[model samples]
Target: MRICFPVSQEKGWESPVFGHFGSAPAFVIVDTDSGQLEEVTNGDLHHAHGMCQPLKALGGRQVDGVAVGGIGMGALMKLQAQGITVYRAVEGTVKDNLAMLKEGKLPVFSSDWTCAGHGHAGGCAHR
Candidate 1:
């Protein structure tokens, strides 16, 4: 499966997962089955609150899922509309979140989990 993680930098698997999906500095796309990884800059990183276009920030790459600490309801709804599942990411590196996902430890993101506002400027508080 190809899982996309919003990260603070371009550290590949070692990159720390950013707290907010929309404002992340970058993203890491990992092919869990093949262990292939690619880093992409978040083009829409500076957009206004509630204006996150996930696919655009991801450079239009199709992903099976998105893992992040938190997301706004608008962005979350957009992702879900695209048939992409969102998972609650742990407070660790991309590798750690990936492991948690493999173990079914990551919670599926729902409307209840979305941030009330645009989410923190740095990210969002983990639930």
Candidate 2:
């Protein structure tokens, strides 16, 4: 299974994921089966706030799930439509969150918000 994480900073995961999907920087694709990570750096082929051209660039890749700090309704819907589970407003670093996820300590999110990129604002647990 493959998972996607929208990150604010690079830890053990990546740095480019900190950028916007469409206008940010890049995305990190982790292969759970092999524990290999590939950074997709085509900023011109991604979308953040909503489904535009980037999501289309994803083609039919099946994303087992996703965890994003902040996002809007459009992107949320687009992901859902693609059969990709959407977890929103999640907090903590990518590694921290991944640990919690393994222990089933993290909860699946549904609210539309995060570290603020579009019109929404506020993210980070210390916030």
Every candidate's lDDT: 0.89, 0.52
TM-score of model 1 (CA atoms)? 0.92
- Residue by residue across 5-115, what tens digits does model 1's lDDT show? 999889888999988898899999999889999999998888887788999999999999999988988899999999999999988999999999999999998788787
Off by over 4 Å in 1: 118-127
Tell me how far candidate 2 lies from the true structure as C-alpha RMSD in angstroms: 4.9
User: Scored by Cα lDDT, where does model 1 land?
Assistant: 0.89
- Candidate closest to the true structure, highest TM-score: 1
Candidate 1 weakest lDDT stretch, 10 residues: 118-127
**Prediction RMSDs, each to the true structure:** 1.9, 4.9
- Per-residue accuracy of model 2 over 1-127 as CA lDDT, tens digit each: 7877755444446342332334434455567788876655434443433454536434444567766554455556667777777554244555555555667665565543422344334222211
Give the winner by lDDT: 1
